[model samples]
Target: MYEMNVEDRGKLTSNRTFLVKNITKTMNVVDKLMEDGTITDDLKQDIEAKLTDNDKNRKLLDIIPRRGPKAFKAFLNALVKTDNAFSAEQLSPGAGAIYKVSMTSSEKGMVSPEEEKPQNQHSEIILPKKWPTEQDFVKDFIVKTCSHSEKGKLQSDNYYKMRSKPRGRVLMFNNFVAVAHKVEEEDGLWKEKLQMRDGTEKDEQSLRRLFEQLHFDVEVKKDRKVEQMRSDIAEEKAHRFHKDADCFILVFLSHGSTEGIYGTDGNVLTTDEVKSSLNNKNFGSMTNKPKLIFIQACCADTYDKGANVADNMAKDMSDARKSMSALNLNDPKLENVDEADSKVEKSPSDADMFIANATTQDNVSFRNTKFGSWFIQALVYIFRNYACQTDLLDMLTLVNKLVSEGRASDRDRNIAVAVSVFESTLRHKLHFFP
Candidate 1:
């Protein structure tokens, strides 16, 4: 039922609010299903009237029960994707309530059944023996039905007969790296007009290229709010990708605090939120894969003095917008590249996960308005020259060495990087060799 109309949109603070709470106690979408398993006439009318490319939407009786209410919610979200990606078209799950090949569509966003792509025999997803909720299945349905090259009937399976070869994907969610200041007046008029993060553009650009060179399918997003960030790390797209990829690399470059990173809105988003988004328990297929979260933000509010003690560090989690110059590696002496071609046996159990922070909990780091932040530059340098030769930790060690030791032309501050190796499953060294 349309418990809350468009005019009531502002009062909504949660999905619960959207589905319940009319003074009349009238059944809302939240209580969409009555005891008899029938839906409100209002909702049924809404679904039926919404036609997709001249194809009538399937009857409501056919869409709901097969996947349950959560699948219906998934269908709601799918509609939004369709509206955004195509010209406001829609489709149903199918007439028979089957999970796959149920909907038929000619629109850019809706999938047709005959065109459905079969999943690879090796395709995988991490899940508990019993699902906690129907919503989770909805998310999985969306991911399983999509592919890299196409939308709607997108192929979830990408065959890889040679699973022994090193395989992985790098996902980049670096947004609002360069956000202008926003101000709301007493009258509530909002204004924005200034670039705050001068060097982050360079940081994102460099990382994207570096990962692509390493054969990682690089995906990037910029200037997202808190919900967008949360949806990203915890959603179907990212989770599904982990099923086949051997390693998952996340590079986040934005204003952050000791507690968590900041969304474009400047609110704190905790690191735990990030860890849960890619949790192994939730992602069974990724239990044995190496999950690396590379954070180029500050974990402390204090600054380090030149006395060379790490007790005091430098750099605000805020944007380091001093200079946009090219990266400069002091290049004292290069490490020997003898171990670049080595490989170790892969682990198939739940392990091999860690997080890399640019600074510890009490110190600050430095960034140049011209050359991006110090940590990101060091990361690019180490990966470009050493990933093929060194293991992941060793390369990160080099990253720590360079960032903590180098002096910036714009700011003369040095800080140590932090790494939390939550899991030690990498029995052998990692190589980005072809």
Candidate 2:
């Protein structure tokens, strides 16, 4: 095995104080170090537990020298990749100079000697070019799709009025950690534990930014129990802001079952309760206005083994026929047009509500610890790019397309895919006109 270089050790030791103070993205660096196999999960937890960035950095520095031979190099690379290049420079000036020169050359489209060298293509599976992060992908997608100038005017008759100063009030409930509890069954009391969601904060941040840009007043409630969530919803419903708002949006990011979303306390909050609480009868001010609910949670405990497009067409058609038959359109009750017209006169409490779940019924949603849920990522990206022009249903369709096309892997290396599902009772097209 290669030995740790004394020179690299010296660089880290010499600039320990400077690195501790200057490294801002310590978790990112920790993630990179862990990915490189330079640091173990235990060491990563130790670094993350330090409470402050400086403390985290100090913990990281303390661990690096004791790690394997490649640790120092990996740490430096981590710093550079995580936007702490200046700290990397302080640790090793020569490495910093090389990185800067490489970056500058890249910006100017001049390939370095190292990059010009041919690689053994047979040794690796070359993936298609992709953005380094979901954010970068979204930014690039938006720039390519949206024109800087406004393209068309929206007639009020065709679209919902979305011109209120603060177009809507958005309430987001993000539950990262589920509270462990015990279930008393016929056998005995069994402990139930849920894994903490790692990348949900990224989803929350993306959504907050997007909605704020869309001119909505946003409120985020983190790790709330069911009753607390209900209370917050009640308060939101009673808030006078709805008088001036054109729409309402509720977002839930949590672990869930087909029954409903889970609170931190492990208690379930059924989607029906959520809708009933905010229905037009309960929240009269929003009558006829759009009420959009976006849920990023697993609806069930199953994975989707996606089918080949060509082979699945016949099966899809058969399923469609079954579904249509189940609808019983031929029933004599369905032939009463006058009855339907009379029913339409009494507006349903759930009218104008749009509910979009991350995955279809009986399928688990996919979440990336590094990025976020595939559904929310695509939703934010598509909405940010197309909301200025596209209607809500069309935008959600794009979200469904983008998310379903994404692939995720489980611990067993099983490839899984997800498809977003939405149910809309929207009476008119809704556009943010951002």
Candidate 3:
């Protein structure tokens, strides 16, 4: 019946104005999809590769009267209006339906074979106030998916019950390791004094390769200033596709002070700024998802010169991640002041996010000019080797071990790097795909 209708429609004249209207509406749909991150950059590039074939297919498909893009728009419009427990053809008979709606628009002059001047019902048409954002879509999905899923038992009495795993994205980007060394004064008059970082390229390469293997869409930004860094990170969090990711990773590599990390221009940007930029509340779709941030830089310039140092070999804290649970803030305790501090970490008590600092507050984290930052080296190694078998916190602790005692026998200079969880909803153990 569908084919016969198509055959009959093929006999009709292809009206130029009607084709333009349909194409215009279709473009609107595609633009909205791209904004929602349903059609990603990578997905767009893939489709563009076969542009000629795609265009031809699009033109041919558009030949079918009252179908294609117009039909899709009408379907979404119906979803917006009704609260019906929607279902489509079962994906494979017994398998559950993948909520699809196939309906034709009631717009007049739909280039039909009948040549009937159909009465218009354009006045009754109701469009959505705003297109559903990707985050909006997923939160809705989570509510629906969880409603249908088999409920699982909670892990511990202290741990809150989670019927559904919080959804999120694995967002990774380098704020661009900037030049931190001092340059000679304008006309070579005064010698500028400073510490320097080298071989960060090693860190970048290792990260790009590692995430590629792990199947994350990674983007690297270099030479980002303070305001610029803040904007970009915020934009990423606000991106339409961000809500779909279950995990987020932010790796910071630059010179930092006891207060916070610095941008390429040597201006300090507080971790509080970072917190705001990456706040989970900003993304309704990612409210309970895990956001992992790894920062590697000197917390300060106070390098120890071996005076009041201990007379023993530095002990690598091999059991760091095990003790990590004793950190971070979030959904469980943030809003409830009475249970705060005691139930979770202090201050910025958001949820489902981890902040890893290379050095503790008010201390310097040593870096090697020859290899790379000690912290990043250990992080890449542990992630590449241990992520499959180890829990995330444990993996970070293992990284702390290698970085703290694992540095050259130069001096007992700095303390261990730390990873803090903020608003953590990590109710269960997670592992990277082997």
Candidate 4:
């Protein structure tokens, strides 16, 4: 390990505040540093002991300067490896280029030309390759998905028309707190106490920004009782603007069970009731338009113990089968309602609706107190980045892929994962085209 120079130490100290605020995925950085022998087990525990990401990052910055020469470089490498190359560049102007050269050259069985050059010859700095920002990622996907050939292949009549001045209205019900109540079940009587959903405001903000960017008139109702929620839904259904809109979207962020969502008063609002209220008979104006619903809450108390796949074919197959067996598909009763109408029959009331749940039945969805629910985070991110090029279904699929790969911890520190599920009845493709 090469010794970290005085200049690098100075840089780390001066940029402490910026690093603390921006270094997300802190555990990944800590793990890499530990693997590189830049930090001790004791130090790792101390860093993890801090409750928030900022505190953990502060601790990490404090410790690295004392870990000798290799610590600085190892920390920078970890940041770049964890999709934080922007931070690495901020710390050292050409740090990303240096790391990339080292990595790509190693794979090619050659030394980096930068490393081979004489010390004095490094006076001219090589500009690092531009790393994609969050907005850049969104733009790239839009450009790729809207290419001439890709757009040409789509049939005009196969997609829902989304060209309205304001595409539609979105109603979001964010229940951050629930009242305490005693309930009786078949098993026994139990007391239900719900805690405040911390960090939920962040999710509300994200959703508002996303929908507004997509040209939707967004309304958010927070901490409403069951009756209030029902009344709100009814008002939306009767709103005159629906006659000029292309679609409707509803979102629920609250504590819930397989039966339904919970209101701030601890009253249960059954999922069936929600669907029935938004059916063709009630929301007549949107009968043939798309109606989308997103629920971010736990379906049950169970945690998903994710499986690991091995390189060996036999072991991989065994893991795959075990995973398949563990999955429980909890399909809603209204999910299969037919959208096609014959001369002698009427289309189902639930036609053109798409329902998305954060997790499968009999599992709990994970949330970060500092960020938000894993499901919502992925949903906002994918929609923001891929909506221009991807249809609604494809965007939700990407959300599933992103959420399933995320690992979280329960109250007992057990490793838990989540998988998002969606059921769609729309006959045509739904695209935001934002």
Mark the 10 consecutive residues where model 1 has the least summed lDDT: 326-335
User: In model 3, what lDDT does residue 74 have?
Assistant: 33
lDDT of 4 by residue, 6-123 (tens): 9889999887876886676788789878887888899999999999999999999888888888777888787766645546866875565566455443232222233334221212
Weakest lDDT window of 10 consecutive positions for candidate 4: 136-145
Off by over 4 Å in 4: 1-155, 179-192, 310-331, 334-345
Q: Which candidate is the best by TM-score?
A: 2
| Stretch of 10 with least lDDT, candidate 2 | 323-332
Q: Which order, best to worst by lDDT?
A: 4, 2, 1, 3
Instruction: Write model 2 residue lDDT over 264-336, tens digit each, in one string.
Output: 8878788888877777667888988999999988776677767766654333322111100000000000111
**TM-score, ranked from best to worst:** 2, 4, 3, 1
Compared with the true structure, what per-residue lDDT tens digits does model 1 show for residues 61-167?
23343434344444333333332111011132221223223333432232322124342111221222211111211111111222333221212232112132235
Question: Which candidate's lDDT is highest?
Answer: 4
Superior by lDDT: candidate 1 or candidate 3: 1
Summed over model 1, clashes come to 24
- Cand. 2 TM to true fold: 0.62
C-alpha positional error of residue 234 in candidate 1 after TM-score superposition, expressed in Å = 2.3
Name model 2 segments beyond 4 Å from true.
1-152, 179-187, 309-346, 410-412
How many Å off is the CA of 252 in candidate 1?
Answer: 0.5
